[model samples]
Structures are given as C-alpha cells and as structure tokens.
Target: MIKYLLNQSLLSMKKRYDYDVTYMQDILRTDLGAFMKFMAFQTMSTHKGNLPVEALYAARIRAIIWDDCGPCTQLIVNMAVEANVDSVLVKAIVDRDLEKLPSAISLVVRFTELVLAHNPEADELRQQIIELWGEKGLITIAYGICSTRVYPALKYTLGHGKTCSRVVLNDEPVVPKKNPQLVGSHHD
Candidate 1:
C-alpha cells in the first residue's frame, strides 16, 4: 500500500518534470525501507531556510551541474524555473555566464564550485554567505549543494545516468558551460 502511494507520487513527479524516475522505482522495488529513507533525505534539497530563491537555486544548479550535465542537471534547471527564479538568471547560470549573474548569485555559484571541489578557498566564500544570509541561509545553501548531487550519483550508481544533453529553459535549449577549474576534478 505504501509502495503504491509512493509510486503514484513518483509518477506525478515524472510527468510534471518530464524526468526519469526509474532509479527511484528500482529502489522501491529493491527495498521499501531504503526507499522511504531516501525519500526523507530528498527533503533536504528543498530546504531553503532564510535563503532567497536565487541563492538557493543557484547553489543547487551549480552543484548538480558539477556532478551531472544531463537529465539531473536539467531537472534542477526546471525546478529553478518553476520556483520563479528569473529565466534569464537561470540561463546565465546554465551558460556559466558569471558576467550576467548578479553579484550575490555569482558568489553562491562560486562557493558551490569551491565546496564541491573540496578547495580550502570555499572558507572565504562561506563567510560571505553567512554575512549576506546568516547561518540558516548558509545551511540552506550547504544542503542545496550536498543534496542536489545525490540524485545523479544515485542514477549513475544504478546505471541510469546519461551523458551531457541540452537543457531547456522557457522552451529554449541551453548548452551548459563546464567550469574549467572544476574540469577533470570529477566526472572525468
């Protein structure tokens, strides 16, 4: 009964986002307890405590792009748009046009990059985030970064991950730019 309801929820998500949820379905089939736990963990990705929409989604989109450039990345982009983040800003982030992003958002993107890469430099950016948005906001961005990576990682581990594909925003396809600094850091 629980699996039935969960599958229905997954189907709704798949339809709403045009996303693939086969990995989630596989998890459900493999172990109900594990599937329930995974679903609980997914709540972290949506926690935006005290963060502005731009900052939260920027961190999420950046981290997902670092870990995946295909479906998972596109899913984040879609969610960002649905959350009413400006389509133009979403495009700038997708295109890696730091010049086009607002200073605050650009900072969040850079912070996500450095954190994902395990660089000590993220410390400075972290302080800046706390100043701008406070500790709760910092935690929100951290959760955004960490939780956003899990879907793609799980997909790849389950052999369901795909290669880079064109991501669309507002009905137009956008080619994502790879962060040169993070190139070869992972996903090589």
Candidate 2:
C-alpha cells in the first residue's frame, strides 16, 4: 500500500519535471527501508531557514553542477525555476557568469565551489554568509550544497545516470559553462 502511494508521488514528480526516477524506483523495489531513509535525507535539502530562495538554490545549483553536468543538473535548474528564483540569476549560475551575479549570490557560488573543491579559502566566505544570514542561514546553505550531490551520486552508482546533456530553461536550451572563475580570481 505504501509503495503504491510512493509510486504515485514519484510519477507525479516525473511528469511535472520531465525527470527520470528509475534510480529511485530501483531503490524502492530493492529495499523499502533504504528508500525511506533516502526520502528522509531529501527533506534536509528543503530546509532553507532564513535564506533568500536565490542564495539557497544557488548553493544547490553550484554543488550539483560540481557533481554532475547532465540530468541531475537539469533537475536542480528546473526545481529552482519552479521555486521562482530569478531566471537571470539561475542562468548566471548555470553559465558560471560570476560577473553577472549579484554580490550575495556570487559569494554563494564561490563559497560552494571552494567547499566542493575542498579548499580552505571558503572560510572567509563562510564568515560572510553568517554575517548576512546568521548561523541557521549558514546551516541552510550547507545543507543545500551537501544534499544536492546525493541524487546524482545515487543515480550514477545505480547505473541510471546519463552523460552531459543540454539544460533547458524557460523553454530554451542552455549550454552550461564549464569551470568558470572561482575564489581569488580576477572575476571576484
């Protein structure tokens, strides 16, 4: 009975976003307990305590792009758009056009990049995030960054992930820029 409801939910999501959910289906079929745990972890990504929708989604977009360049990235982009994040800001992040992004979002992009790259240079940026949004805000952004990576990782590990594909925004296809400027660079 629970699986029936879960499948209905997943089907709705798949239809709404035009996203593939075979990995999630596989997980559900293989282990109900693991699927439940995975769904619980997904809740962590949705908590944006005190963050501007733009800042939180920026961190999520950046982190997902770091881990994936294909369907997973497209899913995040689609979700961000649905949440009403500014389309221009979403494009800038997708294109890695740091120059076009506002200061707050630029900080988030660079910070997410540095954190993903395992560079300690993110320390100063972390301080800035806290100053602007408090500890909960920082935590929200951290969760955004961390949780976005899991879907792609799980998909690929399950052999259900795809290679890079064009991402569509507002009905237009966008070729996301690869490796744009990061912290300590002239763009900053």
Q: Pick the candidate with the highest TM-score.
A: 1
lDDT of 2 by residue, 1-188 (tens): 99989988999999998888888988888899999999998789788788999999889998887778679889999989999998888999998898999999999998888888777789999999999999999999989988988888888888887666878888888877656444334233
Q: Per-model C-alpha lDDT, please? A: 0.89, 0.87
TM-score of 2: 0.93
Residues 1-188, candidate 1: write the lDDT tens digits.
88999999999999999998999999998999999899889788678898999989999988888878679888999899899999999999888899999999999999988888888899999999999999998999989999998989998899888666778888888887778987777542
Question: Least accurate stretch of 10 residues (summed lDDT) in model 1?
Answer: 179-188
Top candidate when judged by lDDT against the true structure = 1
RMSD of 2: 3.5
75 Cα displacement, candidate 1 (Å): 0.8
